[model samples]
Target: MTPREQIGKQAEREYILHGKRGVTPKNLAHKMGVKLSALSQLFPTREDLILEVYRINVQEMNREREEALDRALVDSGGKPLSIESIMDARILPLARRCIEPHKGVQYQVGLSRFFTESSSIKNRILHEQFADLTQRFIDEIERALPYLPREEIRRRFQMTMAAMLGVCGILDMAAYGKEPARSEQEMWKMVHDLRDFLCEGFSAPVQDRHSPSSIHLNDGGRQWQVPLKDIACINADGDYSRVYYASGGCDMVRQTMKAWESIL
Candidate 1:
């Protein structure tokens, strides 16, 4: 590889090991067995190096996803694309990457920097790459479910992506957190459950916003009503419960699980 490419690879490794806040030019230089001045000469700013690493990683991920999609298509022998096939090609690989050691940490690190970084350049780079990947997946999904409107497909795709990312985040925390380590089988089960949940969500008809069943909620001083069917799930937390909506909104309400169950 060229010197610039080598620097980018080394920087990515540093980012994975130390996370966004932990990585620095000086430490990266030390790890690379080079002087700070040499590294500075190659990358004038730390952000530049970070952006390069992000670009390389995004390109590599896209390439892998494309190859997986191709293999799935070939394996089907010209049969109609199923949601399971598309998911196998798309989601499972990402879950594996998130669970794998060292290598998968690259994804976690990239996602962290993507959200936490404030630089306009960084945001543009991340957003453009993410949008491109999302569009490609949506196009493939359209082929699988042609009957659904493009807007509805996009909405379901966004929700599925959010759930998949949340699973990855949780896995990352479990791997590095104080809790006991989860078995590989358990991790895979979580991923499969997420895939099943997403497939069901994609197949389900869109909920009507004008449904008569509504739940009254109070957020501090503000009171509002939410459609009952819009609720995706509820989690009990002591005396209060957290409500998750299918539209991706969440709220904490002063109600118990039994109260919610009895009301429903």
Candidate 2:
């Protein structure tokens, strides 16, 4: 491999073995039998090296996911893709990777950490890639559940992604012996269980039980009921809260922010 690729690979290995914080320039250079100055010559900054590793791993993971999706499409034979199939295409690759030693899942965990804690430029680049991947999943959900509203589809997509990330996090801990690792069969079972749960959620009718359809507000002697969905946002104003609706109307209710938090 080229010097840059070698450094990137060594960096990834370090990250897998010791986590992101361990993949510093000195450690990587020592691991690769090179001087720190030489390594710095290839990557001017530590962030540059981290970003290279991130790009390599993320691109490979995305390629695998796309391949799985293509296989699913081929199997469908022009039929509409079922939620199960789409989910399998989306999730199974990551699940498989979670079992592989010192790779895949670890890389994902590191990428997530880097995105949250890295510089603004790095965060922006990662966000663009993440947003693109997210949109792809959202688009697949939209296709599977055409009857669902766009907003509902996006919400379900977010929930599904959150669950997937949760799984990754758990498996990552298990890899480090911080948590128990499941057998291959058990891991596959968990994957299917998650898929089944998400499918049910996506197929179910939208019933937002958390947010009341309308809330009653007593303003002076006049009492008015407003739809919670219509409210764009709520602002705190001393003891009272100002509620702004998407329709451009505002109301000051004799409710504290704490009360609005509970009611909303």
Candidate 3:
């Protein structure tokens, strides 16, 4: 490798091993058997070196994730990808890569510190780098969802990201605060549930009921007929009851449980 590439790899290793606390160009130079002046001439400043290492590390992670997604596409035999497959291809590989024992914790704590540093230049560059990656992820989502309008695709993408980040933020804060190490199984389950929610939110609306049922119910002073299987549960609210159905809507009745049962 070239001297600059060598410097970057060495610096990244040192940063990963020692984290943000003990990493310095002087120490790195000493470890590399080079004078501090030579390292400074190559990297210009300590911040420059740190930024390069950080960028390279993040890029490598993204590269692996993209490869995993590509493999999934190849295995699908050219069929339109399901939303669940898309979500798994996007998230599960990264989770597996990062969830290895101490490595995961080190990466989490180290990167969090790197981005949230008060140093203006470092913070700005890290923000830009991450924002670009996030936009690329959204673009991929849009491409996968050919049935959605452009605006709808963008909206879903934003909500998907928000949900994932919000959940992750909660876990990170708890773990960093030394509450406990959250179970990876639980985290994956939460992500799977989020995937289901995103699929429901983004995909086409279900077909409206056309067939009338023998079971009749009163809603808003008008009688409506729905199948018994469509009724999920009855929610009692004070003097009234709300009947939740499986067809993505609910109906409110002006009668109590006893009254409704008598009619049945």
Candidate 4:
């Protein structure tokens, strides 16, 4: 490899492995097994290396997206890709890969701070690159009931996002607060129920002229169950009832999976 090219590769390795922002030509020289004086022939400044690493990440993310598209294409046997299905099949999984749990508190601190302070960028990136990931799910709700209006779809989307954000934010707060309010199981239940409730509201079909009544159990906080009839399925006012406490619509919302296992 040319000395210039080898220096470039070394700089990327530093950034990816160590998050080193101010990588000097000397640093790259050390990393690439070359003398500092020799390395300066091609590169000298830290920003040059920083800019290169940033461009590399963008390129890698695009390439990964392309590969995901290729796999989806093969899986579908030549079927056209829709933004929604591609998200479900690829983007969500990719996001999960970004979070790793290993022997450190820094990740928790960093991720929590990002969500709290930079949520707009975070949301925009997710929305734009994920091809309306959350929106695609919301669109599913509208498709489930063809007669639903666009405004209602938008409302349900907002409610779902609010509920998701609430779950993500509150659980982290609980982790670091003065006292943990509930065990992991209980916390999961709350989030699950919150999501289920939102989805049920979105997917409400034409109410049976006589929607059969079922038992209502606060479930002793074990499993919050309100019969299928009670969720904020359709609103005359066109607002999603996820935040509306009166609907008792826990059936459609997902409760924590752990709770069900314990109950069984």
Candidate 5:
């Protein structure tokens, strides 16, 4: 590889494996079998390299999410895919996309940590990019549930996204443990259950008792109802505390509330 390309790929690996915490010039040089001076010449500043690595990873992740979203969209077959279906599709490929120990998920999680702690200028830019990323799927949600209260639909959408990122935040090697079978099974279960529950909540009528838990997506099943509290990882206060409490970066729940306030 050319020097720049080599540096770029190595930088991505380093940052994803370590995030802002992982590596220094000396470590990077040792990993890449180069002199520290040579690495410094290539990377200049650690932050600069980290930013470049983050940019590359975000683009790659977007591509993965898009591919999965497209598959779900195409499979919608003239009908709309629900919010859960979209999320299920988005994170499924991560079984492959997130293969390297705690690489991809850690990068995503730690960057979120960094982002929330960042200055307003940086956080605002991060929020804008994040909102734009979720906007297309949000539009699809709007279309699928036309009569739903628009602002509530969007707030729930934001919470659903927070749930999505929460998985990415916590899926670590240590968390996964040694039993690959158990970890994979649990992760997959998490995906399926959350999708089914949230999609129903998203597609439900505001006052309706029916929920995704009561319905089956696979063969036309009978309609049923579940409590809203049962559908979310919420607290006694009826807010999305479980997910937000675990947010490694920005406060998504509070931000969603702020977003709803702005619109209403």
Candidate 6:
């Protein structure tokens, strides 16, 4: 590793292992066996050093998450990922880390504070960088949901991430093993809630309840009537939905249900 990289790794190690209590250039310099002045040359400010350490750490974490996703996908034998499997692949690992070894708690708390509290220019830049990188997880979800339109994929992906992040915050609280105390039951509730929320979108609708006669489809600016008995099924394709009926198949309409009603 280059001198710069070596400095970052050492800083991350110190910060994670003991920096939670407190860490300063002098303290880190002492730990690195370097003169304070030398360390200062390498990292001009505390934020600079902390951000560097976090940037590296976030990259490593993203890599691990991606690897887990790949493994989950492979294990499924080319099938789309289930909500339970996705949560297991992504959240459970970190949750385990938070309680085990204890260092993981420190690491998570440090990162949570760095992103939420720090207003440094470098911190903001790193924030955006990680946000884009994090979207890769959403891409994984889209892969698992290849049937959904891009717009629907984005909507569901955003909600799913919101739920995931909330769970992380709760896990972080539990890791402290104190204050606003979380019970074991509460943690399990969060897991079940997340699963149910995602499953609502993926699970077959209660009896595919949309009335066939009431359904109106618009395809390429032309309106079509879909009478219940005449219809076979409605399926989604990439960017388009298809309607299969007794007569044959046609691309599904993009109109809203209400709008379809208005036309009728």
Instruction: Using lDDT, give the best candidate's number.
Output: 1
- As for candidate 1, its clashing pairs are none
Better of 1 and 3 by TM-score: 1
Output the worst ten-in-a-row residue range by lDDT, candidate 1: 203-212
Task: For candidate 6, report its TM-score.
Answer: 0.55
Descending-lDDT candidate ranking: 1, 2, 3, 6, 5, 4
User: Which ten contiguous residues of candidate 6 have the minimum total lDDT?
Assistant: 203-212
Q: How high a TM-score does candidate 5 get?
A: 0.58
Tell me the tens digit of each residue's lDDT in model 5 across 1-264: 787667767876665556655546676778789888888887777665665565555566677777777787778875787666676655565434543454545555545555543475356545644566677767777777778767777778877766766655555434456554336456556656657766776776675423332311111243333333333332222332222223332122322333323322
Give the TM-scores of the predictions, in the order they appear.
0.70, 0.70, 0.56, 0.37, 0.58, 0.55
lDDT of 4 at 92: 30
**lDDT, model 3:** 0.67
Alpha-carbon RMSD to native, per candidate: 9.5, 7.5, 13.5, 14.4, 12.9, 12.2
**CA lDDT, every model vs. true structure:** 0.76, 0.75, 0.67, 0.49, 0.58, 0.64
lDDT by residue for model 3 (1-264), tens: 998889898877777677654457788789899999988888877777777777766677666666765676688765555676766655554455444465665555555566455578566664856576656555656666775666666666677766654554444334466666567666666567767876777676533234334467776679877777888878777778888888878888876887656555
What candidate 4 gets wrong by more than 4 Å, as runs, is: 1-111, 115-127, 173-181, 203-264
What stretches of model 5 exceed 4 Å from their correct place? 16-44, 77-79, 94-131, 171-182, 207-264
Clashing pairs in 2: none
* Pairs of residues clashing in candidate 4: 189-256, 192-254, 192-255, 193-254, 193-255, 196-252, 196-253, 196-254, 197-253
lDDT digits (tens) for residues 30-142 of candidate 4 = 66678877767566666556555444443455456566656766876755554344433433332322322331123333334334433554554455444544454445445
Residues 149-199 of candidate 2: C-alpha lDDT, one tens digit per residue: 898888788788789867755654455565676665666677788889888
As a whole number from 0 to 100, the lDDT of residue 86 in candidate 5 is 73
The TM-score, computed over Cα atoms with residue i paired to residue i, of candidate 2 is 0.70
